[model samples]
Target chain A: MVSDNFFPQPGGVESHMYQLASKLIDRGHKVIIITHAYPGRTGVRYLTNGIKTYHVPFWTIYRETTFPTVFSFFPIFRNIVIRERIEIVHGHASLSNLCHEAILHARTMGMRTVFTDHSLFGFGEAGSILTNKLLKFTLSDVDHCICVSHTCKENCVLRASLDPSMVSVIPNAVVADNFRPLSQNEIDSRRSSAPGPPQPLGPNDTITIVVISRLFYNKGIDLLIAAIPRILASQPNVRFIVAGSGPKAIDFEQMVERNVLQDRVSLLGPVRHDEVRDVMVQGHIYLNPSLMEAFGTVIVEAASCGLYVVCTRVGGVPEVLPSHMTEFAAPEEDDLVAATNRAVAKLRSGKVRTDLFHNQVKQMYSWTDVAQRTERVYDSISTTRSFALIDRLKRYYGCGIWAGKLFCMCAVVDYLLFIFLEIFAPRERIDVCKDWPKKAVPVAKLGEEEDVESLKEGGVPGRKRNSRHRREKRDETDESSAA
Target chain B: MTTLITILTRLASPPPQTLHTHQPTSSTVTYTVTTRPALTGLCAKLGFYVGISARVVLGMVAVLVVCLKWCVSLGIGISVLGAFWGEGGERGMRRIMKLIEITDGTYIIPLAILVLFLACKRNYKEESLTIISGLGLQTSTTSSFYLRSPSTRFISTTAIQDIFIHEAFKGFEVRFYLAVVVEGEREVVVVFPSMLPRRGILEEVWREGRKCLWEMGEKG
Candidate 1:
């Protein structure tokens, strides 16, 4: 996978790539990630799960995305591809210049490429217009496209004008282990074998609505600021635990001060991703007032933590969870306040099965399922015939009136550059690195024969290896399926 | 300098107006000034100042530095060219002098024509809108010493459909007025208030303006 966002920069994309790559490795696939150098994090590094990562040195201009030095990345990229003997190149995030450049180069080198779009962008903005054109250019020759949500798939298809069938809807998954709720045994021990079982809520008990997101304008901080005072005034036993900080945090603090809600509202400035579950479990409802989102992974994490979600119905959020787990609201102050009120009332009435939410969410999404689906995409691409240069050129020719011609010229130039490199640095001269030992999938007959031999003989190391592999696989399945 | 000022004054000489019986409290006026400072503004990194006095002096110094830098760079370029041509020795200097003497007339006509062309062009006019109490609004503009009489267009507060207050970067505030008549005619009004020495004053004006428009609805 090639992306600008990776480890050491904590974000949704970074977490998604890490989780997906690790799960893919577990499923018996050798995965490597290529990214631009981050501060103090340059050179090759091996992450957990033995996933190789190559951090190439490049100049980053904004938001950690390297400046678009298109042709400059080709030499190093070609060397990595040759050395690794990679058959497919998977790129993530639309705004990543490295991903776009790698996709172009990978196609030039006659390899199957897949692009995963993680966010939504409106065509009305000038920046979006330019980015959409670039997306159209890159995705023109790509084998398949993956989107985190169905809405995102629609958005990607529309933006790139790709065939709908080629675009797949693969939602982002949260690791259930990391976001687990309080177990029954723990709850029982804490409450001294707990009175009855556990009530979701009581009338007199304060309902802490948790909000953990960057306090930015598009995150609907304005709507949040407008609704907080009214929500407090209307609901007497409701409090808020706001985590994460941004430019709009001051606005929130000012609103809290103006409404004199310091006692009721606790601001835990910024919390790490791992600490999110700890903060989330402290609340009964997770309030997400974001105006725009592709797939709200935090809400799924919240649900996994057994917190009822209250989020604005915008940009794939509604499709993320079932109605039972979430209360949807329009992107407005009145609607958000009403939604919170509804969630609070439901919590008070003990109607929502929040305790059972963890198990239900675990069944809904898993990294194993995502990796399996991604593998299917890879399998399909290998069987399909590779597109001719003219066919690829034809796809790019339909991007825009002038953009079409410009893109075709770029493609032609890139193809020529690839041919020149092929002649100059003949592929035969490059040395392929030895692959790591593969846990081969043995046939049933061979396994049976081996089992008999192991029983006849004293012991076999292959028997131990087979048993250990099966145990690890069983453990993974058990942990993933466990609530 | 005297001739430049005279030309500036002549250029701003206002056109004759048909006097009306009703005089408005607020009016708009236009005039011209030298375009040299604006060109200097483009050359320098000096931002447009609203009201702070200290910033104006700093801006002037920055523009002056840019002007001096350009002059010094040009002098160095000419000296370097002269040094390269010094292989011809003293004879090269004499030849250049003769060449200049011969080309002086040829350069004068084009320079004169260019100056005349530039003089015909008017300097940019800066527009300001002032909110007058018990009246609609007044607009005015000044260039050099010439102050042209402003013309006002009265608008009833009842006509205002909506008022939008936009706070730009660095405390700059802009107000947009959307007005619609009962007959379905639409009118738009844009206003930019002077940046005060202190913050919050523009926001105060915005609130007051919004209040006035809303109160007009009650009166209507």
Candidate 2:
């Protein structure tokens, strides 16, 4: 797998890649990641579930995406591909220059390529136009394109002018074990400590609505700022826990102060991705007023934690969960306020079975299921004969009247470059690296054990399995270097 | 910008007649001015031409005359607005420009470039990548790219290696522009300065160079 967004940088794409890679590794596939180096996380490293990641040192331009110097990545990328003996080079996130470069190089090396589009982009903005053209060029001959939702698929098709059949809608999955609701034992312990049966508040108990996302304009923080005061004024029992930090965070803080509702709104700042569930379970409702989203994985995570969701109807948020699991709102402030009001009423009436949400969400989305589907994509691509050089060029040629020809020329040159490289550095000279140790258990057993382990370790501050493993590995490597 | 605002609001806002109550005419019979469907279609076609006329005219000027690209782009933009949306063509051109601006910047410039690049496909001995490729290549300790022939030496970067692909693109024609690979004090700089039509070819060459990288990688 290749991407620019990865660990040390907390984001949707980063988490998606990590979770997917780990899940794929659990399914007995030797998954490795190739991403640009991040601060203090350079060179090769091992992540949880025995997933190896190579952080190639490159100059990051924006948002951790490296500057796209097309052919410059060839040498290092070629090294990594050869070392791992990668067959199918799956790339994630459309905005990643590393992903595009990897796909182009993988195809040149006669490897199958898959690209996953994680975000929705419109064709209007100058940035979008340039991105779409670049996307068109890269996706022109990609074996297949995976989109997080049907809406994303439609957007990708329109932007790249690709055939509908080539694009598949695979919704992102949340690890239900990590996002489980408060267990009965925990609730019992809490009741014993507080000496009251979890206060089914009569008429006026505070209902905490949680908003956990980067406070960015595209996230509809403006709409959230507009609606928060109104929602508070209308519903006396509601308070808020807004946990995230972004450029728009100050705006939210300002709104809370301006409305003098600072007491009602609690800003937790930026919480780690793993601690999101902890923040989520404290709330009665999850408020997502994002103006745009591709899959809205956080909503799924919220539902898994047993919070009633109130989100705007945009991008693929509508299709993520059932209408019963959520209250839909338009992007407008008035509509959001109205939606929040409805959710607050639903909570008061006890119409939503929040307790049953954890189990339902578990059944709906699982990393194992996602991994299985991805394996099928790999199976299909491997079984089918790879597109011939001429065939690939022809496909690229249909991109645009001029773009088609340009792409064709690119493909032809890439093919020639491949031939030249074959003569210079033969495949026989490269050494295949040994694979990481695989568990002896069956794939199904491994998956089930992973879920059980994750569940057992939930909310345990000192368990720190992932961090511990990373620390141990780093220490061992450090000692070895000293020797 | 004000005209843009008015036209946009006029199109989006409710029709003016909808606001007022209708009064019966004194005349016993009403006369209707009918427009033919074909005539309307013809007008729409004419409007489309007018809408795209700016792009077409600008493109012609760019291809026929060699000048600063941005000046041509700006000049043609102004001329198109004046010539196609003059007093006579205002109504139709307004609708076209409105649609263009809203949907996409008329896509005039990009579409024009695409056409020019495609049309200007010529056989050249050497294709060049531009200085922009210098962006990230400076950090790499050892970076190499392919050109047309395997023997074509790239200067300014440490020692370079070549793989001859005989009969590939009838002899591959790719050049890298300022692709720097730093090793200690010495650096390997691969420079390919792509001219107009050659720019497109250079991009193609860059895309094609991946194969060379892959092969040389396998040879390692």
Candidate 3:
């Protein structure tokens, strides 16, 4: 699969790409990655699971969308496609110009293409318009599409005018074991013998509500600003612990000053993902008032950390958690305030089993499950590749009157390129790389044991897996998958 | 209010309509004539334009008059006023104002350039809904200026789309602009810069094909 987004960049899309790639490798696909060059990175670097990444040299114009020199990329990309013998060209992220250009060139070079969407975009805004247009141009001829969630699928359909059927709803998953909740013994030892698990807060205990996302407008920092003063005024004992920073940092500071909440609301700035468990364990509630979300990984992380979640019911947030663990509110200032109040009250009353949320959330998501679902998409598309041609034509047909025709022309061009490749430079000319050590069979069995193990783990079990048998089996799986 | 009280009540208080001497409307002619719908189809036209025109027309014109005197009012007009008129809203008012401003800019800018060579010894005489080229005075959505000439009525035809679309070399594009004339019906204004063969020449051909659109309001 070809993508311009990979490791080093720290974002939801970036993480999604890395995890999905590694998992694909585990499943025994001879997965090689292609991305624009990062500052320090160049050439092919094999990541943990022998996943080869090709960092192509390209102009890094505005926020890493490679300078769109359309035909400039075709020569080098064709060389890579010839070298790797990539049958599938899969691109990730909407804003990546490299991804879009790669899709265009890959189509010209004749390869099946898949695009994975990670964020939700509105029909409004110039950025989305530009993206939608570019997306329309790229997706107009691509084979299949995957989105992190149903909302994201709807957004892709409406944005690029793809058929809902052509686009699969494959929600993003966390390595559930990685996000395990802290055990009572671990918490007690870590808290310096904090007197019997800190005793579920008396009516007077300072309820520390935590916020860990970067404080940006879409993260609903504006709502945070407007709601903070009122919340503090009414709920005196309620304190806030805010982590992460962005343009809204100054606004958050000013709010703290204006309301004299200097002592009440603590701003811890940015925290690393690994340190998230430490930050989260300090608060009774995790507040996620994100204005829009494709899949709220942080809320899941927060729930996994044994914190009752108070989040806005926007984008894919409502679908991520069951109602019992989350206090869902409309993306409104008053609604958020009321929801936070309800969460704090629930926490104070000891009616919520936030302690049990970690195990529950772990069962719902995993990188393995995501990889399995993705494998199905690959099979379905590759197996029915012929009839899927008409399905693609119809999808491109719906893009728009002019755009529809333009898209069909692109698809036809791609088909012609496929024919060209078949005649000259041929599949025989391309040399396939040997597979790296794969997930051991014993590890596969252990993964299957997650259903039972997750329950007994009680959230935090520092059980890391390593087995020789699984690695050998993983290699066999890759050989078969490629064949 | 105190000036009115001093003028009318002398020393006693209460600013009232009767006792005041220096009439606020003294210099202004009070035309109480409710403008009858003079043109047959004009009533509907007026109605269509009212939500947009009420600020520059209805409120001042229902008690219609050509004000012999003019003063600049600094306020959020039509939009805020629309709330009082009990019709549409700030949206229609803004649409009307924006249209008027755009038309004035597009035409007047060229006209003003043409006028600079004219030997009129006028103090930058400007007109309402007037078309002129630049050089003597400047105007646009971000700018408003009086010609040394005293023309009150202003119209601007600011084809901003033309300016931006001219530079774009790659990718498919659509440019939309709307024109509302004080004298004519509102219409959309468009300009196609060039044709992209891979993208297509349809929008370009349509652009060159439609000359009547450049002339005046005949909808496509």
User: lDDT for each of the candidates?
Assistant: 0.72, 0.69, 0.62
Ranking by TM-score: 2, 1, 3
Question: For each candidate, what's the DockQ?
Answer: 0.00, 0.01, 0.00
What's the true lDDT of residue A350 in model 1? 93
Error of 2 at A30 (Å): 1.6
Which regions of candidate 3 fall more than 4 Å away from where they truly are?
A190-199, A387-398, A401-432, A437-483, B1-220
10 residues in a row with least lDDT, candidate 1 chain B: B166-175
Candidate 2, chain B, TM-score (2 decimals): 0.21
Shift in Å, residue B128, candidate 3: 85
lDDT of 2 by residue, A1-483 (tens): 999988777777877887788888878899999888776556555555667777788899977789988877776677667757899999999999999989998998889999999999988999999899989999887898999999999999999888899888888998899998887677776555554433444468689999999988999999999999999999988899999999998888899889999789999998987789889988989999999999999999999998999999999999999989999998999999999999889888778888789899999998788888988998888877877788888788888899888878777777776665554444543445546556433553354355335533432121232333323433433454578
lDDT of 1 by residue, A1-483 (tens): 999998777799988998899898888888889998776556554454446677888889888999998787887788778878899999999999999999999998899999999999998999999999999999988999999999999999999999999999899998988889887776777556555667767788889899999999888989989998999999999999999999999989999998899999999998877789889988889999999999999999999999999999999999999999999999999999999999999989999989889999999999999999999999999899888899989888888899999989988999988866665554654445434334433443354355434433333343232343333333433454573
Ranking by lDDT: 1, 2, 3
C-alpha displacement of B17 in model 3, angstroms?
Answer: 99
lDDT of 3 at B206: 24
Prediction RMSDs, each to the true structure: 28.8, 27.1, 29.4
